[model samples]
Target: MDTLELQAKAKELRQEIIKMITAAGSGHPGGSLSAADILTVLYFDKMNLRPEEPDWTGRDYFVLSKGHAAPAQYAALALRGYFPVEELNGLRKLHSRLQGHPVSSKVPGIDVSTGSLGQGVSVACGLAKGLKIDKLPNHVYTMLGDGECQEGQVWEALMFAAHYQLDNLTVIIDHNRLQIDGQVEKVMNIEPLDKKLDAFGFNVLLVNGHDIEAIQNAIDKAKTCQGRPTAIIANTIKGRGVSFMENQAGWHGTAPKPEEAEQALQELA
Candidate 1:
């Protein structure tokens, strides 16, 4: 998709995210809105996904390491035709497949269950290594929160990926600065993130998370990089898109009120 198209899709996805979160009365809107552009580029322009055949073994894999941002992924999946967009209304409802966090078993396009944070990246590592062993071309992509990088296991997984030279695994960090508690740096500093990843042998690419062109270009570069895993550190706002929500940490896990949701939809419109 072109720049304008991606921008339009992102707007729609943000709208969908706010709508679902408001309906559910709970969700991680901040990160979900922040990741809209990256997911839009991946699903619409980059990833080779078989929406009609969600179980296709040869399809590329995507794991949301920051599972709280499932709303953004669900919106993209629905828009990509993996499931009915109407199902978005069922988000967080009783017995709904669209739980607060993504459950791979229930969701058609989800590759792994990821609620414990750092573990999902490890799962991506295993997928990449397994595909390499089997000589398959499918790549593994995972998104992690900047705060989640505080987990010691994240580094462990990166070490394993680098040691094995799993270039097929691309890790995208949503460097949104804030977590559920507060600013990531204040809570648990993960600065010099590029240097850290580089030391761990990752081909690090830093991009403006909201820039579809830059994000897509980074993903393209990641695909061709050899002998090292790639990490795209996407600098982004905690709450993106809506005026009142943008950059506000309070929005991290708070659903918009009915009035707030309406205002957000108008702003997107």
Candidate 2:
């Protein structure tokens, strides 16, 4: 897709995310909105995915480590034809496949069930290792929140990925600088993150998470990297598209009111 088309798709996805969250009444809008651009670029532009065959072995895999932002992934998957776009409205409903967090067994496009912050990276590493063992050339992409890094298991996974020289594994950090509590620095500082990942033997790239061109370039560079896993530190806002929610920690886990949702949608429009 061209840059213009991708950006247009991203805008539509962001709007869909707002609609889904608004209908659900309780979902993580801030993080979802923040990561929309990245997810759009991945599913629509960067990754080679087959919606008809969700378990297609030759396709690239994506694991949203910050699974609270499943709405973002759902928007991308729906746009890519993984499931009916109308199912988005059923988000967080009881017995709905579109749960607050993605469940791989229930959701056709989900590669792994992820909601427990730090575990997704480990799962991604396992997928990468399994592919390596099977001599598969498919790449694994995982995205984690800056706050999720507080979990020590993430670092352990990082070490394992680097040690194994999992060049096909790419990790993206949604460095939005805010979590449910407050600022990431105040909650559990993981700054100097690039330096730390580099020291851990990763080919680290820092870029604006919302920039389509930059994200595509980073993904391309990651694929060619040798001897280590690549980490893209995506500096982003907490609630990127909506005016009231941007950089506001209060919206981290809170759903917007009806009026707020309407305004949010209008802003995106």
Candidate 3:
């Protein structure tokens, strides 16, 4: 997809996120919305994927370390043809594959089942290392929430990724600056994040998370860096693309009412 098409797809993803969350009457819409463009760029433009062959060994992998944003990943997967888009409405429902958090066995595109903070990156690092051992060209990408950086395990995973020098691994941090409780800074600051990532031996690239071209460029650049993993600090707005929800902490895990959903859809349109 071209830049315009990618942007359009991102809007569609955001619309689907709001619809799914509203229908399910529960979800982390704020983070999902914030990460829409990042997911769009990866699943639609960057990753080596086979929607019909989810288990293809040669394919690249993506892990939503911040798994509460499963709606964003779900929208991307459906649009990418991993499953029927209609299945999205069953999000968070009993017996549904599209649960609140992604499950690897149940979901078609997801490789790592996540929800426990700070674990998915470790899994992603493992995948990268395994691919290296197998002499595979495939890459591994994982998205982490800014708030999730507060966890000690995240740093441990970073250290591991660095020590192993998993150059094929790309860590995309959705730095939306807000979590469920409040602003990430007020709750627990992870400031100078880029510098910290640099200190951890990552090839760090910072970009506006909403800019498709910039995001694609950063991912491409990560592919060229040798001997260390890459970390893309995507500065984004929580609840992006919706007027009332943008940057609002309250919307982090709150489903929108019907009227609010309508308004959000209109805004996205």
Candidate 4:
């Protein structure tokens, strides 16, 4: 897809996220919105996915490590025809396939069950290693939040990926600089993140998370990288695309009030 098309689609996806969360009455909108652009590029432009055949062996894979943002992933999957868009209304409802976090068994396109942060990258690395061993050309892409990096398991996964030279694995970090509690800098300063990843033997590419062109270029570069895993540090804004919610840490896990949702939707329109 072209840059303009990707941007428009991302905007639409952001609106869909807001609408779904509003209908459901609760969700992690802030993170979801922050990661929408990266997901847009993956689903609409980069990844070679088969929506109808979610388990297609030759297809590329995506793992949402920060699973609370599943709403955004769900939006992408539904819009891409993995399931009927109507099912999005069932998000987080009793007995709904769309749980608070993604469940691989229930969701057709989900590659892994995620929600507990810091584990998705490990799973992605494993998948990449397996594919390499099988001689498959497919790639594995995983998204992580900056706050999730505070977990020791994430670093362990990074070390493993680097040690294995998982070139087919591309890790995207949604560095919105905010977490559930407060600003990431104040909560746990993970600054110089690019340097840290580089020291761990990763080919790091820093870019504006919301820029489609930059994201596409970075993914392309990662694909050609050799002897190391690639990490794209995507600088983003919490609650992106919504005026009142933008950069507000309080919105990290809170659903907008009825009036607020209405206003937010109006602004999106």
- Local distance difference test scores for all models: 0.94, 0.93, 0.96, 0.93
What tens-digit string does per-residue lDDT give for candidate 3 at 112-200? Answer: 99999999999999999999999899999999999999999999999999999999999999999998889999999999999999999
lDDT of model 1, residue 253: 92
lDDT of 1 at 167: 97
lDDT per residue for candidate 2 within 1-269, as digits (tens), equals 89989999989998998899889998998898889889988999888889999988889999999999999999999989999999999999998999889999999889899999999999999999999999899999999999999999999999999999999999999999998889999988887899999999999999999999999999999999987899999999989999999999999988888999999999999
TM-score of every model versus the real structure = 0.99, 0.99, 0.99, 0.98
Local lDDT at 7 for model 1: 95
Best by lDDT: 3
Cα deviation at 35, candidate 2, in Å, is 0.7
Please provide, for model 1 over 63-117, each residue's C-alpha lDDT reduced to its tens digit, 9 standing for 90 to 100. 9999999999999999999999999989999999999999999999998998898
Sorting all predicted structures by lDDT, with the top scorer first, yields 3, 1, 4, 2
Off by over 4 Å in 2: none
Query: Worst lDDT window (10 residues) for model 4?
Result: 11-20
| Total colliding residue pairs, candidate 3 | 0
lDDT of 1 at 226: 96
After TM-score superposition, the amount by which residue 235's alpha carbon in candidate 3 deviates from its true location, in angstroms, is: 0.4
- Candidate 1 vs 3: which has more lDDT: 3
Against the true structure, candidate 2 has what lDDT? 0.93
